[model samples]
Target: MIKNILKSALNNFQAFLVTWVVIIIVNQLFIFGACFAPYCLLAALPHTFVIAVLLNYFLNAEESNKQLNSSKIDSNSDFKYTQADNHIEDNEFEETEIPFCPKCGSKMALRTAKNGAHAGNKFWGCSKYPKCKGLLNI
Candidate 1:
């Protein structure tokens, strides 16, 4: 019930107007016992304002998270992976199959082994780099 109110409030000004009216009516009838008193509506203002601010904060946060998630790589289409056997010395993956990191689940990127015995050879490394040391042979 509260969730529905919040969702509606996020999308429509009518929901806020309705919520304010209900708060004012309830305050005037139950708290003040003077249904016609104008001052009784004042008491509802703070309550309505606090609820509006809190709902706005939470709903906007949810919207931002949705946008962030939508911008992420699709995995199946965004990255191109190639056969591990076609080792190109540069940062480019040959053009066959994309592999996920074994240690973490992130997509792997083509990287060169700069200093080890396999220096100058190309392999798949975790896109996350220093944070995740997942590696694969190419």
Candidate 2:
């Protein structure tokens, strides 16, 4: 996806450069005709703006459609379950008490901080606050 986006941005830049080069060449040609230069540029300006606007609109629409399709598939998947089903109850399970960090074997403790994103808000922080101070966004 990142590569695709980079390719698209490069393509748009190349196209924009080619278009302005052509426009400049045409305007230069009309300059030799004395009275037609201004008129030619005036005519080309509106068309260029229109084409640019249309391209932007279509690109946005395509991106929106891709997002919508992915979300639709996620929502329609069969594996999703509600919280109350009790197939996996969180509180019923015994929390593993670790005296050391699993990754580095350093001392660890049960701490709480803001975590996870809900709706439009993003709130995330390390479970070990004021000490570990590892913050994140979810």
Candidate 3:
């Protein structure tokens, strides 16, 4: 139900596009009905961008929390866990292997934003930089 929807949308690629397309379509319909101009599409960009950014922030935070909890539980096993599991390694978990870009089927590179509000945060960027700007936040 709700959990399945959230997991599917958060973890899958096609679901992401479907979810956003529906949102945009509905928003555009409302704007068209009220304003009756194709030019309003440009005005919709900022609204949609802000919504997407905010949603990404909260979803990423929740996903990180879930992973942290799961890793802690796993660290309790008989095998020696990494020092970070027992409070020795850096506070951050080791960077996991990056997945291929869902959009373009290209390799994704780990990149840090040199200039932005998220300047130091790491995210995955598509190898096809100028052509395909697919991204996945880490």
Candidate 4:
């Protein structure tokens, strides 16, 4: 039913959002704030299908990494690695996230900007706050 489909889509929103981000980035190659290229329209169909397939990928990010025998994620350790039996190893390669800080290249934490021209706006701030003052708007 339509209701069931909507509910399923809502549950997989992370993948949907990621797919949209990719589409927007690709569309940017043609123009900013607009997409008039025929390739963009053609690519939309496959992107939607890929988004649905990536539902589990986006929702269980750490699990997916384990499946690939990649770096183990430690959410409790602020996504940083520590020497332990069941923790991430330093030698393992790290995946580069698109939203990492532009200044210090650290993963930006989602935070509210207190004082700025766009006060109260949600944005990404470098995890290394006092040490690195990198920020990005949502």
**Which 10 residues in a row give candidate 4 its minimum summed lDDT?**
68-77
Regions more than 4 Å wrong, model 1: 1-94
Measure candidate 2: CA RMSD. 13.4
What TM-score quantifies how close candidate 2 is to the native fold? 0.25
- Per-residue alpha-carbon lDDT of candidate 2 for residues 1-138, written as tens digits (9 for 90 to 100): 545544444556665456555655565466435334576667667655545444544565576578779999998897767677547767788865445443444555544444545545543434454555543333
Q: Name the best candidate (by lDDT).
A: 1
* Clash pairs detected, candidate 1: 81-96, 81-97, 82-96, 82-97
Q: For model 3, how does the per-residue alpha-carbon lDDT over 10-69 read when each residue is reduced to its tens digit? A: 565464555465656677877556543657767776676455544544556577578879
Error of 1 at 40 (Å): 18
Candidate number with the higher lDDT (3 or 4) = 3
TM-score: the better of candidates 2 and 4: 4
Question: Each prediction's Cα RMSD?
Answer: 11.0, 13.4, 17.3, 19.9
Evaluate model 1: give its TM-score: 0.37
Candidate 4 accuracy as TM-score = 0.28
In terms of TM-score, the best-performing candidate is: 1
Against the reference, the lDDT scores of all candidates come to: 0.72, 0.55, 0.70, 0.64
**lDDT tens digits, residue span 24-136, model 1:** 67666787786565565665678866676455546566765676577774544667887788566765744568899999999999888899799999999999999999999
The estimated TM-scores of all candidates read 0.37, 0.25, 0.34, 0.28
lDDT (0-100) at residue 69 of candidate 4? Answer: 62
User: On residues 1-90, what C-alpha lDDT tens digit does candidate 4 reach at each position?
Assistant: 445444544656676667656655665555444554676656555655555545534555564447446433343446555576786677
What is the overall TM-score of model 3 with all chains considered together? 0.34
